[model samples]
Target: MRLFSLLLCGALLTGCASPPPDDPGGTWINQAAIDAARESGRLREALLAYGPNLEWQIHPERQQASYSNGFELVEGRLQAVGAGQWQVTFYGDYEEQLRLQGDQLTQVASGYWPEQRFARAPTRGDEQAPLGSSFEQALYRDYLGGDWLIEEGQGQGGLVRFIDNGQVQGLPGAERFALCLAGDCAAMSGEHDSLWLQAGDQGSPWLFVHEGNRLRIFEAHNRAQFDEMPEYQPGPQRWLLKRR
Candidate 1:
């Protein structure tokens, strides 16, 4: 009788033993998109390629996941393969590996691009804050160092090669590219992501809006003139470019 009781107790204990639950599962956003440290390195290249508008939702049940940024959005079914190792399978048989550590989550996009980092939101509200100027500067350093296309230049799409950090770009007359303020070219881009970049001959700086995969460079004569504008939309002539 005692042996039977011991065996029953052991069986019950074994049945109750289960793996730990998903601790990082919940709404998460880009860390750099928040009030991050004044460090350009924090705005990771992989994350930037994902786009500034990033939103992720990991279900508490640990079985479903969803990712959305400015460029793409998809939902997937997730399964834990090992400790701190999980895989998400999207529609059409696409799969992505994921690694979760505490409040930070790293996702490998489509098993191609480098893994991008994300942080759990402090609250369920999921508030979004404007990005800083440094984030824009960081883009050229790593994200935009490769070749890009001038969406519509000289009546057709032209090639624009960013040799390194937009400084030595191969853009016809605008040989030297730099983002600065219109009033004072050397002034800091305070509390804003869109800064003025010179397109050379305009005798003025162009308003450069940093959008992942695409860029909108609007001609702004001066700070006072651009400030009066209410919205930012499509620009005319040699103002748009897309990643190639």
Candidate 2:
């Protein structure tokens, strides 16, 4: 019958060329390349010690995969393989190829191994920073370098200025770093939306514990998940700030 109808049309084109099944669930953060490296300034305080508050956490119905600097994804599955491309396959076997662009999700590794990007995390209020939280490494080596008055009390105060390049300023209406306004302080220099720095590019990465000079601020989840190698105590939420 004409070679069995050409072998049943080559087995229906090899079952429609297989490959395409792996959804993987929840958690992911690159916040569009951390908001495009905090808006072009190329924000890089060592990538804020890889702590932008938990990034990546697939589940695939329990196939497991976790990472926020702790690394766990012993096995993986992301496999989209088309339009925006994707292919994951974790540590056990190791494979990569993820690209998205719009919301950013890169990870096209091969040899040098660095790519990695991600996003899509804020589903609700978004707050998860407590796994050995050094508060983004003590806000990038001690309260984000320079200029801070913040004494909001009797004399009522505000004059932040942290600027290692990411830029930030306060003084004018200052509704607590309201994207800078005191006469256009560069319109919130490289926005990261600081509530105490929430992911590089500067300011409000939260969680502090200085001590001698006082600096205890913690509320972004109530802080208490130690493991990044110990040495960090001060959890009661006093919101004390002093580093002029």
The number of clashing residue pairs in model 2 is 7
TM-scores, in order shown? Answer: 0.40, 0.26
Give one digit per residue, the lDDT tens place, for model 2 in 125-154: 122433212222223323345655666432
The sequence of per-residue lDDT tens digits that candidate 1 reaches over residues 1-244 is 0000111334355533322445546566665543332233233333344433365676647599777653355788988887887888889998888888766778766545555777655433221322222233333445446667777654247777653234445565565565431223323222333333345555334455556667666654333345563333324445577778
Candidate number with greatest lDDT: 1
Q: What root-mean-square deviation over C-alphas does model 1 reach?
A: 19.0
Clashes within 3 Å, all models in order: 0, 7
Q: Candidate 2 overall Cα lDDT vs. reference?
A: 0.41
